[model samples]
Target: MLAIETKQLSKSFWKNNVVKQIDLQVEKGEILGFLGRNGAGKSTFINMLTGILPPSSGSYALLGVQGPNNAVKKEIGVMPDYSSLYGSMTALKHLRYLSEVSGKKVSQSRAMDVLQLVGLEAHANKKAGKFSFGMKKKLAIAQAIVHDPQLIFLDEPTSGLDAESVIQIHRLIQRLHQQGKTIFMTSHNLDEVEKICSRIAIMKDGKIRRVGTMDELRAYYQSTITVTMKHAPIAATDLATLEPWLKQVGAQLEMEASHFTIQVESEQKIAEIIRALGSYKIDIYRVDVDEPSLEEIFLEE
Candidate 1:
């Protein structure tokens, strides 16, 4: 079953469509990263799915239930880009209040556990008014998962945290995934998303532009493969003799002493080049195939 599904879901304000006909589905147990520039309608799309704003057209289902209702709300947790916290209340109380209002009241000990997971247990009694910006972010994350919801939506979960705090959050996310929870998050930290997300979705102009695993996206954007080989030195005359073989494989070779670089059309040609080099009695010390990174793929038009 899909953890979340949408069919031509859209939202608009009069003449401007903020989210334009987005058809997307997120399978269960996936840490899907949503990426887009500012004013890309990412927030609007999220708000619609969370039931904060009604859609102008189309439909969506959360955990296989149509429409937004108390039952569906109880099964999903949302940590918005900006959450309004009760400044006068302590962190512990904040979780308790939000938990109960969501129809799943957590006990005092359970509240403390959530705080600990986010590295805020020591400040359990500290009022949010006096907490640092990072601390507030932690509390917001804590409240989102206090009820142990099956699905989570974290918007910029580590936007303003220190290195140590980022690591803590990464570990917490992995632990949740181990228990089969579906995570749909949005972040500008491309490196972090590349490291932790199983799949990525790139949105633009209020529509999804690309969505796939990292390798699939790379292949779609990359036109050529680069293969670097370290081998025993060969004479310029001998290297020139291999031009016919290289041409047959649709590859171009550039050599620097014992180091050689070959640009090929596909990975299949790379294997052919390797075998051909072996026939020439060249002792290959190493071979490296360069693949495009997530950032490189995301920047493509």
Candidate 2:
């Protein structure tokens, strides 16, 4: 069974329907990236799925247990963007507390191991309230995984973190994946999501508008491939000479000095232009083919 399944699930606050009917599935061991703008109901959807609130309509299942099931809840970990830490408790104490609350209590040494995993070993004895925002975020992460849950939800996991902290969190996420844990994450850091997530789902105006892998989403929007070539400068006459070949490949060309940006109909159609260029001994030094960047795709979505 899938780690998560939703069928037309929705949530509303009085008159405003923040979360519209959403049908999404997260498979086992898959890192799914969920994205949306500020008011797109991403948080509301997550809140309902995590049992913080009930859906206004429809239903969902987490690890095959429908709706709010305490048994399944114990098997899932959540690192919400807005979580509070106890002012009087040390980081290690927080982890130990959660471990017990989840009914999977471990030794103090194991809690220390978790603190180390989140790069909070030095602050294990420090009060959570005295830690920096980034350090507190790390503490929250440690609490989430202290019980060794099979599925994790990370909401804006690195939002206010420093470069080093962000890198550490990314590495920790990799370890979780290696342990065969399914992760459902939401983040505005498009570059990070592009690097780590196996598949993506985009929500818009309270509904999921698109879902696919990077390449699949690229193709979903009829986006063309842009190939930038570095070669010797081309004269207008040379470009005109290549017009027939370019037309055959259905490419729109832009030239600037030694660089040529060929916007092809698609990736499959770019090969013909490259073959013709090679046949002309254009001496191609480098070729970089790019689809629209994740930010560009998100804005367009």
Candidate No. with top lDDT: 1
- Candidate 2 error regions (>4 Å): 233-240
* Global Cα lDDT for candidate 1: 0.90
Model 2 has a clash total of 0
Candidate 1 lDDT, tens digit per residue, 1-301? 8999999999999999999999999999999999998989888888999988899999999999997666889889999888868999999999999999999999999999999999999999999999998999999999989999999999899999999999999999999999899999999899999999999999999999999999889888888998898888776666888766676666667768878788888888878877878888878899999988877776774
Tell me the TM-score of each prediction against the true structure: 0.96, 0.94
Global lDDT of each model? Answer: 0.90, 0.87
The worst-scoring run of ten residues by lDDT in candidate 2 lies at 243-252
- In terms of TM-score, how similar is model 2 to the real structure? 0.94
Tell me which residue pairs clash in candidate 2: none
Question: Candidate 2 residues 243-274, lDDT tens each?
Answer: 66675566667766787777777666667777
Question: Which one wins on TM-score?
Answer: 1
